[model samples]
Target: MEFGTTSRTSGKPGPRRERSPGGSDYAVLSRQVQEAGLLRRRPVRGVVLLVVTAAMLAGSWWLFVAVGDSWWQLAVALPMAFAFTQCGFRGHEAGHRQTFHSKRLNNAAGLVFGNLFVGLGFGWWMNKHNRHHAHPNQVGRDPDIESGALVFDGDDAPGRTGAGAFVTRHQAGLFFPMLLLEGWNLHVASVRALRSRHTGAPAPAAVEALLLLVHAAAYFGALALVLSPLKALVFVLVQQGLFGLYLGASFAPNHKGMEMLSRDERLDFLRSQVLTSRNVRGGPATDFLLGGLNHQIEHHLFPSMPTSALPRAKPLVRAHCGDLGLPYTETGLIDSYRQALGHLHAAGAPLRAGG
Candidate 1:
């Protein structure tokens, strides 16, 4: 949804004020959030969530193993995928050091939940995510907006030839289906990153690589034991496809279609985050489904703040943005997706024309 970018006083537009690109706006907001105690870690909440997610994972696996019918196993895959996504979210929180005060503990959790269980590379994800957070929608710098199957901007659109031209012409319509492959894409990317010298710490990356191997072995071995080869293949496709779709659906709305900053743009932290981030409008159900990511604006503003506390920080952040005449975009989930798709279609226009 659109939000005003002009100052309001007494229900009327005030004199326009220009903010310096690198002003102290973010610093002031950070101090306010810190003084209000929103930055404190919530270990108990983190522990409870961890325990509950583990139990759910165990239960789903048990159901998958115990059920003989392919249909029942397929049904079980739904919860299994959901549980896996939740574990991935936990890993995300740990990666941000929001789940634990101790860096070592957080790293341990990130490795276990992200690398071993979810098949994501913790170190690789951390480095990439940090860059995204540092430059949310920056054209050249933000890896999230970098050239991919679905280009985010016309300038980054693919060459007008072969699959690139075909996909760019239909990216908006193909976006959701493409997301079905995201799980596999992420797995390959993680493996490549771990193997690359640029990822740092060869020994640790090797250990993570081994753990991923173990996870794959256990995952396929369990499925093979429970079902025929064909069924096992189907199960893998269903589970991973759902996992990727859920992940992409939940994350795409956070920033897509809002704003695209130039590579050399110098924006204050507050303006950069609020303008780029879009919040999803919902309550508890949204929180559970999105892993409290519905409050994208707040999360972007305070990356280390616990997810549990994001909802509480939302109104405060919204009000502050309103007072400062900053953009605070929030929209329903379906509308957000539509906006994202629309943005993609518009971005691909130049490529389609060139072809």
Candidate 2:
């Protein structure tokens, strides 16, 4: 019945320990958090953020056009990338229903920010994200960790050959550079998902497709209209590349290198969320850059909780985890990335050995 008997002072997770699987621990903590009103929706704050992000996106475009057909336009693409990624963050919050009290309102915002503004599919992303939340880092369940260009699971590492093997063998070094293409990959994936949808596509899916088309038209049309051919091509490359890099950097630190669950491994809600998530310690700037995702443990514990409330919820969750002897991992931003990359490097070790 006693937890926390083991040491976790190093901030690295030790071997998995046997513990009770009852849900009462989480229920009690949830009730405590609810009493503190940490779970309440902060509509005004979310709306202000959404509005500011939209303004930023518009301003970036305005600068893009005003700067005219010059190499200096690449300078404008920098902020455009940041603005686009912020819009993606807003869509992420909406998908979690953290931005609005009403589910319909949240989905509406999600569709706009995700499909219309960011050219991402809200439905597809939400489905994938929800599965991740339900079973983060689980071998067969979490799509985020699924074997692909980068293998997170050791078992999936050895069989890769040719380009896949070369990439896998040096993934830790290649990770950030590879993120440059993530924006293009997301767009292609979203379009593919929409095209491959079953017959009698739902109204929402149809709406997503239309918004994406509009986004494509406006995004490409504006660049081509304002910039010369070479400039426009460079602008697209710069903006999309940095956008993906920004998003990937913000997200990579949260759960990578943390403990992963095998298919059959089980934990209660509290343990499953808190143990697998790593919080990055920083001030307001970090929160802004990461879109409040630095509080990963708290966010995972309360997915519906507003972004503004995650900081307030952090102490409460940490104390609760402390009381229960659970490992609450947190690190500096740079350190978090290091841990993640270290995991990738370790995962690819077997392939290196074979070569």
lDDT of each: 0.82, 0.87
lDDT of 1 by residue, 54-73 (tens): 88888888888778647667
TM-score of each: 0.92, 0.94
Give the true-structure RMSD of model 2: 3.1
Residue-level lDDT tens digits of model 2 in 178-217: 9999999889888888766644322356788899999999
Best by TM-score, which number? 2
Residue 341 CA error for candidate 2 (Å)? 0.6
Clashing pairs in model 1?
Answer: none
Clashing pairs in 2: 4-325
